[model samples]
Target: MKIDLDRSKEPSLREQICAGIAERIRSGLLQPGEQLPSVRQLAQDLGVSLMTAVQAYGLLEKRGLVESVQGRGTFVRERAIATEASGDPFGWQLAIGDYLPRASFWSQSAVRLPPEILDLATASIHHSLLPLPLLEASIQSALKQAPQSLGRYAPFQGDPEFLAVVAGYLQRQGLSLSTHQLIITNGTQQGIDLFARTFLGPNDVLAMEAPAFSGAIDAFRLSHGHIVPVPVDREGIRLEILEDLSLQMRIKAIYVVPTYQNPTGSVMSLQRRKALIDFAVAAGALILEDEPHRELTLADKGTGRLPPPLKALDPDGRVVYLKGFSKFLFPGLRLGVLAADGALYRRLLAAKSIVDLGSPLWLQKALVPFFQNPQLPRYIDRLNSILLQRSRQVADTLSRRLSPAIRWQRPQGGMHLWVTLPPFLDADSLLPEAHRRGIHFLPGSIFYPGEPESNHLRICWTNLADAELPGALECLCDVLNEAVR
Candidate 1:
């Protein structure tokens, strides 16, 4: 058999050889029961190493393309050759059967809605709030400054200039981190996934708030980590339960959204934040602090200053902080930063490299100038002002319309309000009716890792226009009233 190998191709020599043999097998050029050349002979013929030939054949065997018999030869696997003739186009899907159920549920939750419906489920702000013109100018400026960014992959850690700007920005927020301690991610979701993949393994315990972010739950689940639900109250995650769980199990990591947490807009109190850091440090466990809504906090109402982040309180290298810009800025931008120090950062960087090589360099370049500008804080303050108004509007509507039946705290900041219905009313059961009335919301059940609370739900107030809020809230109130009756 004559096999030609391209010395200068993008794929390595071993991969190329494997592809060549696999292609031949699939095309009937190498028939079933046909023996291929021995590793030594193939190595000699291709002028490659013996290990390269062995790896190629090994890859083909792993791919079910070939089988090696004792003292016989490496022959094409009959089953692999016959897969095409089997006439079942969907057979490949069987390999992913275990994952499909969870995937389906996630997709259902992410279903797109028609324009007529009021979207109270999505976490993103309306397009009108985003600085599209400013972003476009930033992109153009980035292209002019670093045109090669579009053509090449960014460093595994992130772009240096972007990282420097992010480091400076974070430093100003009371959490001082060098560029070396940071890694840019596609979003906070990717940052969560990287942390899970880096630290968690099958049956390794992961402690998170009971009603945590669904995306983080999915990420840890996919990594096969055992989830220990630590309940959260109006203040934040229950620290006593976390301490108990850590004592009982070798807790690998603790995930939290300390400030204006998703779905539930609860902020972690200063005492809890300090205690959490203490627990994590004592247990030698990492704290994956997801702070996407940190900047969206409403203006202080004589509450003094908000407590510093867990990372800020951490004297040890235990906190891995993740911050995202998508929620406040534009969802399509998909920009986020992950900060950690020493070995944890190195491990996370390695995991990130394996996940997607690196996040987009051009996007990072575009965000650098935007982030570095001194006036960015003023822009964020304006954005938060709008969000604060919307949040209060939602709280007011709920209080006026639903009254004592539905209970929720008026979020000081952030986009969502966590609402608890009367005991007899189930949020999931009410979802279809709400959707029918051109309203959409997320049931709180999806956030729980174990048994879900049926009477709880999350409503996002940032997506709808000012005029649309009252009607939507009225429709939701109608649904609740009907359910109670």
Candidate 2:
């Protein structure tokens, strides 16, 4: 085989060689069970080191493009060549079939955007809002004080000091959790995955909010859990329906985002929270309460007091609380906490150990000081203030620009405004035109467990600066107008 290596390219020589052979295998140029040159022979022919050729072959073998025999030489794997020779290049897809779940729209839409496009889909804080100086300082402090953290893996459960800090943080929010009840996760996504895999089984019934977090839906589906969608109003999920469903079906779990729920920024009422806990207790069903944006809320206009999470009200340890730090803080941190008790905690901790051994110790250590700092609350306050301003801008712009064509309730807190368009208009159909006009949003269809409502869409206001909102809204308005016309 003739192999060409570009030394000027970004990929290493080993990667280039591997890619060349893999390409040939995929194109049917390499036949099934066809022997490849020995590592030394390949090295001599390609003018590369024997070790480099070995590494290339090793990667190809790992990729199933090639196989190595004890006495025989490396050959293209039969499956790879057979797949290529079938003339259907996508035959491998049929091998996996529908068993491989499709990614949620939220995940697929999370791509790098052109600099000029208005971003109204991302569920993250802007880089400018991140506490860079504090983070740098924290990293330095962690290295100085707990340099040993970098040398080894953290305990499977989590670092004790980090867990203690997390417990204290949760305590301030009125949910008193012990360190033993907590499992440090890579992020809330992993926590959701762990719960789905550990507590749920194939065809198990999982009750969920109708328009829920796409990631949660994806996780439950991947675990082969059947979803029963309960509708959500401005007051959050309709618990009466949930109660009825629980009574009729054997639900293994109920997942909720009580505080500042995704897509729709609705917070569950206090009455509903208590009722949910009571229902779960009666039904012997677990509640997976995702609270990534719990701390983020626009200041209440009147009472100024927000309802505590369902976890705090849970009397029977029926709630597994997941709190993600990546939303409001640095996204790169990928740190979150899962709080459960008794058998639930043990299972989740064991699952976490199997998933990633444990979260990085240095990162956990660095965050301890960051969370403990007195200025942390102030930082959050500052962030909320900015978000509140942007939220208002989006609402006002929508009202003035789009008017009767669009309807939505202003969120009490959180970054998203779930807007409903005219029944005749499809949000998915309008996305390409909107994109052309330098704007983008998440179509509401992705958030549903059943048939998606094509007229609804979610718009986020936290990622852009205040100056960018008006123009973005204008672009969105123009697109909506054209669509209706």
Cα-lDDT of candidate 2: 0.82
Error of 2 at 238 (Å): 1.0
Best lDDT among the predictions, by candidate number: 2
lDDT scores in order: 0.80, 0.82
Total backbone clashes of candidate 1, pairs 3 or more residues apart or in separate chains: 0
Q: Report the lDDT tens digits of candidate 1 across residue range 377-403.
A: 877878887877777776677777785
Per-residue CA lDDT of candidate 2, range 1-485, in tens?
Answer: 45545576557999978866764554344557676788998898779999999999999999778888766678778754332344656634422213324356435465567888889888788888888988899999999999999999999989999999999999998888899899999999999999999988765889999899987877776685667899998778898798778767798899999888888888888988888888888888899999998778887446567899888898978899999998889778999999998998998989999999999999999988998999988998888888877777777887887857578878888788888888988887788788888989888877887556779888888877767878888888888767766
Q: Which stretches of candidate 1 lie over 4 Å from their true place?
A: 1-96, 99-105, 301-303
Task: State the displacement of the C-alpha of residue 48, model 2, in Å, after optimal TM-score superposition.
Answer: 54
Steric clash pairs (candidate 2): none
